[model samples]
Target: MILLDAGTTYAKILNTETNEKTVKKVAELEKTFKADIGTGHNINRFAKQSVNEIIALSYAGKRLIKEKSFTLLDVGSRDAKYVIFENGNFIHSDWNTECGAFTGQAIEILGSYLNLNYNAIEPQKEFITATCGLLGMGHVFDMVASSVEPGIAAARLIKGVCMSMYRFARKPHKIYLTGGLVNNALFVKSMPVETICLDRFTLLEGVLEYAASKKDDINL
Candidate 1:
């Protein structure tokens, strides 16, 4: 089975066999297929196309995993999403569209300001008390402008992001963290639950898992 996680910046694909799983960037596959897929475009359209490719490759069958009881938190470039799943199907999800500070764009902006790559920042040592993304960004910028070390600043930003996510979670269940920011150790550590940071193939895995389970049903 093939899993596809399509994001605003990049897409990940996971090929899962009985014993092993292989992961790669969707862009690499696009290169092989000679397609134009990149960031800053229509993500939904790209996502559908990417899933279709994975489905065709699997041949075994393709399914989009839609768990009804699981809450999937996807922190993407432009927004943060809180998705609810129940009975192995998606119920509903919420997105923080008005606040861009908690999204990947803020992270990128901070990275640029500090002249540090995203990976260079260290894990957070303190917890953030900010309630909203915009307020959090203001606090972060003030802290950064005061000559705070980039690592700690990054950590604090990550902490704020996690805290924002925690607020939106209505029930206790396994929390899945996906998207670009999942690479931050501080953010993952601050999660209230035993968070699973599927940094590599989260979305793709979801797609493949969904496809496999719904093959017989064929309504997905």
Candidate 2:
């Protein structure tokens, strides 16, 4: 079975039969390409079977996390969502589409605009009051205007974005972090709490889990 986790900016795909995993821009996927099971914003356009992104996240977290009490946070290109599990049961979950706008994308744009490499940037001690990424860019500009090193200013903005997601996840003591931002070294370093970065294909794993649950009936 082919599974997809198609987000606004990128798609993570997996072929269950071959264990091959790949990432592609959403625009680059051919109209003829389709997944047997999938989740995310563009999934509806390309998937024969669709699942709620949050439901996919929950399944992946439950299957991969052995902790009885933990928070699973998935930060993507545009937004962020989290699921809380306690005593091995789902307790609370939230998806913040509004406040999380342009999360990973903003950081990427900032890096590109400044010709900065996030891998070489270090997390900053001070951060701007970036309630959201777009708003954070304004703050970053203000700092740059004040003669703060562009690299330092960018790191601070990235830290603030990280904090925003950390707070959204209810300031968990430790987080099982997933999604695109997990690949950002500075973002990972900026996390205020212990962060366990999961595979970027976590949501795709959830798609597979959902498919497996119906395996007998679906004949996967």
Predictions in order: lDDT: 0.54, 0.88
Candidate 2 has a TM-score of 0.95
lDDT of 1 by residue, 1-220 (tens): 3344555455654445542444344454453332122122233444333333223212211122333356667666666666665675446666666544345666666666667655555556575566555566677778778987656766787766676677765645577666666875556776767777655445554454545556675433
Residue-level lDDT tens digits of model 2 in 1-220: 7889999899999988999999999999999998888899899999887989999999898888888888999999888999999999999999988664787888988989989999998889898767677888888889999999999999998888888888888899999999999999999999999999998999988777776787775544
In model 1, state the lDDT of residue 191.
70
- RMSD (Å) per prediction: 6.5, 1.4
Candidate 2 regions with alpha-carbon error over 4 angstroms: 216-220
List pairs with backbone clashes in candidate 2.
none
TM-score of each: 0.61, 0.95
